[model samples]
Target: MNEQKPIKVILVLGLFSFLSALSGSSTSLAIPKIALSLEISSGLATWVLQSGLITTTIFLVAFGHMGDLLSKNFIFFSGGIAFTIGSAITGIAPTFSLIIIGRIIQAFGSSMIMANSMGIVSDYFPDKKRAQALSYISMFISAGSISGPAAGGFIMSVSSWRWIYLINVPLMIAVLIFGHHALPIPKVSIKQLKSATQGANWMGQGLFTAGIIIFFLSGAIFQSRSNWLIGLITLVVGGALTIYSFYQDDVANLPWISPKILHNRPYLVSIMALLLVMLVNSVSNILLPFYFQSYGLMTPFQSGLLIMLQSLVMLVLSPFAGYLADRVNRQLMTIIGLVILTVSQIGYLLYPAGMNLTRIIIPIVINGIGMAFFLSPNNALTMGLVDKSLTGIAGSLNSFSRTIGMTIGISFGSSILFALLPNVDQITPALGETFLSAFRGVFYVAIAISSLASIMVFVRYLRAKKTA
Candidate 1:
């Protein structure tokens, strides 16, 4: 611990965190292009998205387990290598099948990185410094996600979408080489390792992984509303598996994630708030570009340019929010954030059809500020609430909440969307008013969801007050 500084570890982890986000978001913009180039169907290209998320969600806890039982940086380093190799493979792959394989590998690597990020950060930084450092991770991730479309667009303009995947390799290699020596490793005893390994609920883990993937596949990619029988059957099966896995883990002599985490009121509430917010947030992410295009306010690329405003706001405010979090009530900031988010949703709801840029930027900027304030403080508070030994599992589950929120958010949002505008194919000019009505309808749902999140945060806040 003495040999190297905590900042180095944070810097390296932060960079990798940035890269992982970049890899996912950047690739998203390339999906249609990739499908076109490979001469594959859109349905097949959907798998390109699903594969990475499925693999990431599946391996999160397992890799989190490794973070604790093995080494945090070791997991981090290995993940970086896996991501780089996967990126290289995808960059050059001649076949769609090969690209899917590469995506899985890349996403698996992302799981490893995400599952351990908080654990590594926790290991290095003390309480006073931890929140601020955690803020750094959020900033980088925001920067990467916001920049992704632009990066992909630019790459495709000059070279190819393949270059976007390849972009990850060089930076990753440098991080790996430098971090090979610089990152700190928490010392683990032989006894500790043996105990954690023995206590692992392998059966529960298997069921959980399989259940989530199948469930996600059923509910999100192919829903019962669309595919009726197939979706319904798989959803039921997956739900059952997931429930049984938890039940099994509950009675097991040893649970992979500490049962205490579930029982922790502050942690659970805070984590739920984070998840709920992300859930609504993802709606905006998916809907906005298309909405802008429909309104003739901007092209998809131009809307992306406007959205850079939100990301810029997040990147700017997060550190400042974190600094305030350490000084004041974290939950207060959280509540403020959620409130602002609801306002933003209202902004979207009241968004006039064919509105000017001023109208557009207001809601976008508000949403960004809300997100920046909420995420880091909530993370710092959640991590703070957990025991040191459970940080790996806690962190992974934390990451899981964000991942799952993002994963299902689009589904939740789009389901309502399609329900509202079932007959409408595209938001054409003739149907623009109808589509705008439906769009406002979706934001109404977003507002309701945002309210639910706000209540959760309030509950958590009240509990903290009572305790204090």
Candidate 2:
């Protein structure tokens, strides 16, 4: 590695990752305004978020494998170019369908960046400094997550929602220029290149994509039909295809999620815990905007401000959390973070509809701190469990788990709310009672899940100690 130049390259790529990551959530705050302008229903507007997620879900792992097979720098630059074009499309889109299409393209670009970012870091940093480098990258991610909503709100307040998409263009252009110059290329011998080509897993990629499509489609079916039988069949079919893909990869020695990583006890347990953490965090994020808009009787901007509070807290605390993780017992930090997170969720459940803003802000800040604590440690531990050779795959798996968890959490949380408060029409009335009941139900489920995650962490800790 060309040490000095490579560090510059890694920082630039990290910035690219940060910006792409921000695009997803930045548009989230604009959803209500966009829906109103386009005369679309909330259900339809939700497609804006789901479209990006679906695209990313389908392509993340496949792109990760592609990164390993092709040049990582090439894939990263391609993602940047694609992201810029998609942003332009979204900015000028006239119809809701067009916007969704743009979002899908944008998500595809984001997944490309996500799929190869860790590999870029690994290429630049030696083993000793890699943890700290990862922590810095994670800080950027946390910053993006926090800044997106705030930036969205500010842009929408001053200009049209289109500006949110438009802003990414310049950002992407900068990334393209910097990345093209800065990204490091690994030299490979002709024989090594030939071996890599033979090892690439095209079939595994196809099966994984098919399985994700089926999984998402099945979710849509469940929402529409509300029938257990149909869901059961879908689940069985999807599960079988997923299993078959795994079996093929194992037998073929292809680049599907390496079985060795999955079989590692610490790695598996950490992934599960990280999934649960993401599920709860994402559900809370989705809920907060709805809570402010519907129950708190706030405008879109106000609701966005409320959501931004958590992100801001996360931005401030994440670097410290990452630093702490380097020195402390990672599992202990995760457990403590989850406990705090559960407590904050409970606070949200208990929040009276008519309560003052000050009261709500306290719990929101607490939730944010918990999130900051959880994300860094959980991520550090998950990555630390694997050898450097599999970092790209491990990162892809981590991203996949979080995406799956977010989808499940949002769906399940919405289901709980609908099931509990079927009669509440406007979502503004009975300010204290109705919303609280529904939110409480969601919290109960989240708490249970967090508790289970805690147990898993403890068990892993004990086992690790014994082995040591």
Candidate 3:
């Protein structure tokens, strides 16, 4: 397995991960600018981001299936090129609809990259060193998150928001050119080859994609509380379709989830842990920015700096976490990380309103440290349990879990925040208490979720220990 080191493969994967992360975080920063330029409401402008996320959610598993059947290099190369084209479209779009179309295209490409990168890494690296390679993947993701807001702000200050999308083109081209010679060709199993020849189950693909889109659409619409009938219909239909698709696949003796992955208890628990973490993190990501800027009265740049602090901590600790994952018990690392994350959420919930930067930084920094400890090791553990042939679906499932969690977090958290403080458009002395109350309610829920994740990890660790 280790005839040639996979330095280049890891590099290419890291860059792709970086691009995806960068675009997500930066887009949030550009939302206001985009709204202003398009003469659209801020709420409407969010579609630019949501469209991409929704497209990614719909296509992740499909692309992962393709990764199992297609040449990994080809998938990787095509994803980069497609992302470049999508970015270019967004850069010069004359209308918001076009921008959204561009985003959907970009996300389709991102799905291909995000879906396959980890599987490709798992293929080339031996188990002993795989965690270290995965850590680099986590590191670039953190770097992208850390850089996005600052980069977006800088671009907005000097140029147009269009530059943010445009920026990805050059970076993607670099990856495409370099990755051609760099990424190793995957060794396909006979089963995979057969599946490749037969091609994917297009009907199953459509059902799953439609289900996901419907679910997200319902959630988005429900958040506004303006269209209950449509949302209810969507929720019912989507749930039914999703279940039917899963049943159909299982009955047919083939499924995107494959019985191996679906039956692995450790992998399942690990996914649960990862999902909870992303859910809470995404909630915090949405809330803290508003809290800092609206309540704390910080400048947008200043708030970006505060928001970046957590990712910065995550970036610094990811490699060290990787080193420990290789040497230490991965389950132990996960439990500790979850504990820290739960505690950090508690810290945020209890932190007093009108606190200065120092107090805000402490809890966020702790959250970052917890994330740093959790993600890479947990990822390694998840991938370690799956068969090599199933890694494509496995990687995609992991990314999809993250997407689902983030969607839930943002949708639910934003709903609660607005419901609590519907009139809170500005920071005033009298409205401060109301805002704090809403913030506390949202984060208290986040704490519950994080704590639940911690408990899940603890139980898994104990089970493994007992079995050992």
Candidate 4:
């Protein structure tokens, strides 16, 4: 067996992983510009962002199963190629529809990479080192999360929105080259590979993806129509598909998320906690930018800068949080993080509409730090709850939970804002007030969810102690 240094491999893999995540957040800062340039409605333009997320959400599980069946290196490299191609297409696209298409392709590539990145790390590192390695991965994600928006804004200010997509090509090429040289090859007998490939739950995957797509599409369509019959039909169809998907998973021997992991108390709790975190995180992200631009009377550039503070705080704190999870009680760390998040949400709710940037900056930073504290440690705890052999499945399920949460949060938050606004056609002072009120409501909901997650983690900790 080769004793190739794991850290070096992780560092290389981590850089590519960071870029993969970076592509997701970078487009957020360019939304207004893209909307204006494309002459698309803001709601429609949102699909440019949501398209990637929806694609990623659908494919995460399927890719995870593929990772387990195929070589991780093959999957990773293929994803890199797809991402690069998609970026090139997006960077030069003259039409908005083409851009959405590229985004979907990019999302597909991202799912492939994300589904297996942690699994690869787990395969390479021992348990003692795994948390630290995962910590590094989280740090990269934090860096991407913070930098992507800022970079997108800066590029858009100086050039065009297309540059945001253009920037990925060189980065991806470098990753592809380095990955080819550095990634270790997996050795398996042909019979083993065949069995693994054939064993995948293809029917479950199809049903799950079909259910998610139908549900989202139906909701999007139903939003514009006032016809109750049409709305009811869409709703019923979507509901049926979702129910059927889950029924197949539970009843059949093959399931999208392994029944074994889903049934575990710790694993289920971790999924719930992660879901809440993502919901809060995505809602806050959407609300903060809109709040600053509309209510705080800040320009898009200024709002982007202010948003960067949260990402910056995350970048600084995530590694420490990861290390702490290894040395201290992870459950305690999660609860503490949730507490800080709750405080941050309360701060946002209570902030005066006319407050200066300085007054609110502290709370924003605090919120970011809270996220940093939770994300890495929570991820570690979740994966740690399962056996090493199940890392791919666990990682995919975790990503899926976060994606679903983000989708629901963004959709629900936007719906509330639009419903509350008296005049949806124009941005006015009263509209701003309505939006803020909706944001306040959303934040309150976030606090409740975070609290529930904290309680779940606490209960899991007590159970673990009792068992021990």
Candidate 5:
């Protein structure tokens, strides 16, 4: 019965993880349809997506702290209810404003779930089994990410775009019912909760949340148009807010991210590397479709199929990587993964004009294997560095880094791409050669960023050796 309990927990939590991923990914597919249906500009419609990403990223750490102070069960159940209600509202939204509101609600709920899910897993599994269980969570994330676009596309073809959201209603209901029964109650007490609240720096938390939202919101808008007014104003203000938040932590009784955790050499370096690597990898993924369809003369379908291979390789290797992380030197494995990823980017860079597709496949495969190795092990090591009590915040901090990295990566890459092009808004055949040149430049940036990550990992290695 005890054995069965653990398995049930994984299944239920894994379902929650899947639904969350699907919700995020599928929304991209719905954006164009939404613009057409609502008679709105694509630029305005994009706010529907940005609202969700902004809220989710900003609230993760706060909600993770809530999990620690109160109970993981409290956050997860509330998230489920909020997520379900948000999805229904989104499905039935008559106007774009309502859709944005629903997405914000949904994103807040997702933050709660995201902030607590890994913490629960870490708490449930022993050290020996923790990485393996985390690997399954990673796999569920991959499955949902891979399936979302295709599933959404199919539904939109035969039905209204609203069905993309409506379909999640039943799925969330299932997760809620099963998760309520399967997830164990944490042993948090009201006394403990009160103490935690008293100790927490509420002012710092508020500042941090506001800063993150302002920063990301400005960046998202800046990506489409170089609107310096809103961009510079928000950027300066957000930066000030963030700095103040960190300063407040120095005086506060309890900081959102502990100074001890921030000061830890391996964990700090690992996080920097995670952000850089994710940035590079995301830029590569976002640009590759353009490379294939625009330059290589491949169809959209062919481009998607080719890119899907990366996920397939990740799916195959993630479990093995998790197993190896448990047995091997995690830092060593992570460094190796970074090296492999850098090599793959070089492969992309070196592909001769009019080269055959076969050469690209090898690099893509290597890229996948590298990601599989790095993500699971690095995550394990980051969480391991922190004490068990702060696991929830640690987990959310790790997740937030990835999300922020991806967001910034796309914006960075697009800005550079547009800057190099003859026209910022549209691409024409006259600019094919120009676009290819810009494309190559994007890979150069990726390679440089990835190489930087490798250097950081190697520095950690040297530091570890010195300490030893």
Candidate 6:
């Protein structure tokens, strides 16, 4: 590949990656407005957010396999078109139903992108430069996420929520045209493509998709105390379907959910580690805005700004982290980063109700540094340890794990916080201590979960090092 080709390739990938993050983050700020505009229940508005995540995640494995066996670039391009079209539909839709249809289409396209982007990068960059290149994805995603809310708010102030969805059309069109020339088109035999298509375990995929949706739906249901019984039943049924899906897959040829992935210890550990950290991080993200506004006496903008601090640090540090990931022992780097993250979590756990602004900033800074260090190297480990053919699947699974983590975190964090308060509508001055109790409970659970993840990595590899 020519030097310019690598640069062009990153530009194409980065644009789409940024677009995906922007859609997610920007839409969050617009959800209330959408609900108000449509005169819909908050419940229905939430579906707008959720449909995308569920669709994107469930489709990842299937699309990932396709990217590996058929063509990553093709799948990636098709996804872009789908996303753009979905954007147009949502932008113009008169009814909420149409908006949801648009979201589902967008999710379909997003799954395609998530499944293949890492595989494309792995193909384009040499091993020495791969992690650094991957870090650029992290940076673009962070930029999109941080800018999304601010941008969305600005658009809504002057224009309307529809503009947020509409804006991507021109940008995505530009990326599609650029990517046509930039993304490498790999050559695969017709025989390989045929096998990939014919050998796909359709039954297994359907069951898996059903199970994932039901399970996630159950979690969403649990947000309501009145629906706990239904949620429990749904959760049980979903778990059974997911387990059975895997059980059936064990005997299937060329299974979408491969047994090979489960057997790879390093890859398995890296995935687990990634999931755990995301779960931990997401809890803070979901719970903190409430804390900042309610207990910290901060305005909405101030709350957002405080949270943005972590993303800012991550944006700056990710590239450097990626650079070091290429040169260092990645496992060791992840472990150290986890250690720093543990320290930050501890800081949060111990901090009093007052949450002295200066002291809290220290932990937030540490969390950012820790995440930057852990994420890039760990991302490298996941795709790097797998074979070239499995790279796409590995990347999809990685994205899958992160999405699952975030989803569960939101569910669990909200459930735990509200469960303690029972009927409390607002965090009043009279109930400060009770709110603090629920708040600290989340961090306690988070720290415990993260420690288990750390030990999983540290002990498994410690044993390996000794044996070697």
lDDT of 3 by residue, 190-307 (tens): 7866667474466777788788788778877777777768878987898788768766665554466687776788898998789899999988888887787777777777777787
**lDDT string, candidate 4, 1-468, tens digits:** 256667567766788778977777888767888889989898788788878877898888777766766766677677888989999898899999899889989889988888878778777866655667787887788788877877876787799889888889998998788877788656557787677757566787677777777667655654454554665676578668766876677666656566777677888788788888888777777778677877667877788778788878887777788788888888778878888887887777776667476667877988998888888778878777788777787888788888888876776555555556544644545654566677688778877887887788888878888988
Give residue 394's error in model 5 in angstroms.
0.7
The TM-score leader among the candidates is 6
Off by over 4 Å in 1: 1-4, 185-199, 220-225, 228-233
Off by over 4 Å in 4: 1-4, 32-42, 94-97, 158-160, 186-200, 218-240, 422-427, 430-436
Candidate 1 — what's its lDDT?
A: 0.83
Measured over all alpha carbons after superposition, the RMSD of each candidate to the real structure, in angstroms, is 2.6, 3.3, 2.9, 3.1, 2.5, 2.0
In candidate 3, position 8 carries an lDDT of: 74
Clashing pairs in 2: none
- For model 1, residues 23-120, the per-residue Cα lDDT tens digits are 78887788889889988887678788889988898888778877877887777778899999999998988998898899999988999899989988
Off by over 4 Å in 6: 185-195
Report the number of backbone clashes for model 6.
0
lDDT of 2 by residue, 1-468 (tens): 555786676578668868876887787778898899899987688788888888887777766666766666666677788888889998899999899889888888888788877766666665445545666777677678778877887898899999999999998898787766777545557786567667667797678777766776666665554674776687668757866876777666665667777677788787788789888887787677667877767886777668778877887787788778877888888888888888887777777767478778887898888877877778777777777777777777777777878877776566566567665555774556767777778888887887888788888778778988
TM-score of each: 0.93, 0.87, 0.92, 0.89, 0.93, 0.95
Among all windows of 10 consecutive residues in model 1, the one with the lowest summed lDDT is: 219-228
Candidate 5 ranges with C-alpha deviation above 4 Å: 186-200, 227-240
Q: What is the lDDT of residue 460 in candidate 3?
A: 88
Backbone clashes for every candidate come to 0, 0, 0, 0, 0, 0
Q: What is the lDDT of candidate 3?
A: 0.84
Q: Could you tell me the lDDT of residue 328 within candidate 2?
A: 81
